[model samples]
Target chain A: MKILSKLRASIAVAAVLILSAVMFVDINDAQAEYGDVVINNYSDGAGMRPVVFPHWFHRVRFRCKVCHADLGFKFQAGGNEINMVKIIDGQFCGACHNGDIAWSVENCNLCHSGKPGTPTQVHESTVQKLAQPSGAKK
Target chain B: MPVSTFRAEFLDTVSGLARGAASPGLALFLWLLCVGAAWAGEWLPLANDGIHDPRSRAVKILQQPREALQGLTPDHAGNQVRWVQVLEKGEIRPREKLFPQTVVQKLDLDVILDAKGGMPAVRFPHRPHTEWLDCVNCHDGLFAKSVGQSKISMFKILQGEQCGVCHGAVAFPLTECARCHSIPRPGQSKPVIPAGIDPRIHQAIGQGQK
Candidate 1:
């Protein structure tokens, strides 16, 4: 009788523990929303400016393969080194900024004039909106 | 009276022993049940880690294709590797020293659920899949350490989620099930091909699984 009683007690305890565990299992519904622009810069000894690139905006205009494959981007930032000087010289962004496809180099306040920390300024949105040919009825 | 008392004592002892054995068995069963329950909800770990980052490693090494191939190949020493397939899906493309295209590497798995809720055995191709995609593509972030933890489903796949990130769009279309399934229509029912009687093995060897 004693042994039977002990067995029943142990089984009850095990059942309780299992039931508690099952009941307490946390169901996490947390989801993280990261920004589309992932720019890891590796230039400028004073620490490189973070490139605030809106991927959705650019993706609307160009396919991933264009800049990634054709333009020879290394699939990640800081892999294929890009600098302001290179863009001004028609190497990186300058490839299209020859006054036809994008704003000419004479329009100096385009990409270079930002105060670095401010991701978006009044002039930034204005220039970005006007830069695209989407509005122009060609 | 003494005889009757002895018989009574004997009966009680036997009953006690039976009870003792039963209690232990019951305790063992409970222990096993607890263990099984604990095992049920454990998950595989799939997190993005530094080792998985392809671009970082690829850029650092920047070894020419030939140099990379030469390091890995013994028979094909001094072999010039062609191009690395970024996210391609296909059978292993056989090549000698070098080719116009290199094979992408990624795990190719065929899964079938078994009865009793046990994990189904999976046929996985490890080498070729690694060649095509970057290590970061699946290792840490995509797949968890434990199997079946990802909660991956066909619904998510058709929706272009989870593994769909590459399969339908970048990798081979899942519509081509034969690539992973390998078995012909007649043999689909049997999970494993019997030794010396299977035809798919012959086909795989003949085609080099390309």
Candidate 2:
């Protein structure tokens, strides 16, 4: 009975060490996942959903200076006070995204998908998947 | 019961309960708490003292640049300094280059600004500045990337905007006007005065020549 008690105590200690080790290893892996910035400045109050700006999709095509410097976009998220009126009048994101350059502003659901907790379908890009840090699972 | 006997009995009861009643999952959780407590004890003191704060750490690191440069030369030991010699010798290494190899394309673009009051046009070289600083430092916020987008004026710069951000504090002072205004004199191949020296000293020498 004493030997069995010793075995149980040893097993408990070993399990604790293994669990802590697993937790420590997974912490960094979880943070390495692709991050997206959600721009919801006036969206919710104006009866619209927030725009999810995927950094990976934009970074792959253009340099940081192209949008930030040339287009006069602020560095911080929600730094630029963007509105639908300014966008329609060809300011901010509307400068290039006026149908001819990229996409038209008429497509409402394309940008304003849904609220924070609502079930929304997200399109996964192969470029972003490939760019993930090594040892990160799909 | 004696104190020693009572202590022993208490330990025995606790150990017996741990082995008999407590599950492996509970044991694991308790162990994690103990480990976390120990880690907190080790790190919390240093963090609370502001040593772990990123802003303070960055300030500490940046303060070392002058001292780091001073360590290399004995002649200029504790003297009023200039970094151009260290840069020309290729002794100063940017902190970014010490990291893992990341291919960053360096463009040597020259911007010639026409002087307002008939002073020599300021020839701005991108290569030298880009060697030390990242592009984001000046690109979007300070100066627009698009040509002719920003209205850069000497008065604005004097008021601690644009180039004044670094020049007066870290780089050579704005008093050294000939450094940027590199227009050659009528009879000289060079600018008739060397760059990187105090313009006040140059003016005194010019007065002596006359």
Chain B TM-score (model 2 vs. true structure): 0.50
Interface RMSD of each: 19.9, 19.4
Among all candidates shown, the one with the greatest TM-score? 2
- Which stretches of model 1 miss by more than 4 angstroms? A1-35, A38-49, A105-138, B1-210
Give native contacts recovered, as a fraction, per prediction.
Answer: 0.01, 0.01
Q: Score the docking of each candidate (DockQ).
A: 0.02, 0.04
- Candidate 2 — which pairs collide? none
lDDT (Cα, 0-100) at A72 in candidate 1? 49
List the global CA lDDT of all models.
0.38, 0.49
Any idea how many clashes model 2 has? 0
Write candidate 1's Cα lDDT for B1-210 as tens digits: 122353355456555654576555455544555455334322211111111122223223222222222222111000111112211321124221112352333455534422222212324455545444444455566665456666666466555456654444334443423345453343344334345643422223222123
- What fraction of the genuine interface contacts, i.e. the true contacts, does candidate 1 reproduce? 0.01
Error of 1 at B32 (Å): 46
Ten-residue stretch with the least lDDT total in model 1 chain A: A29-38
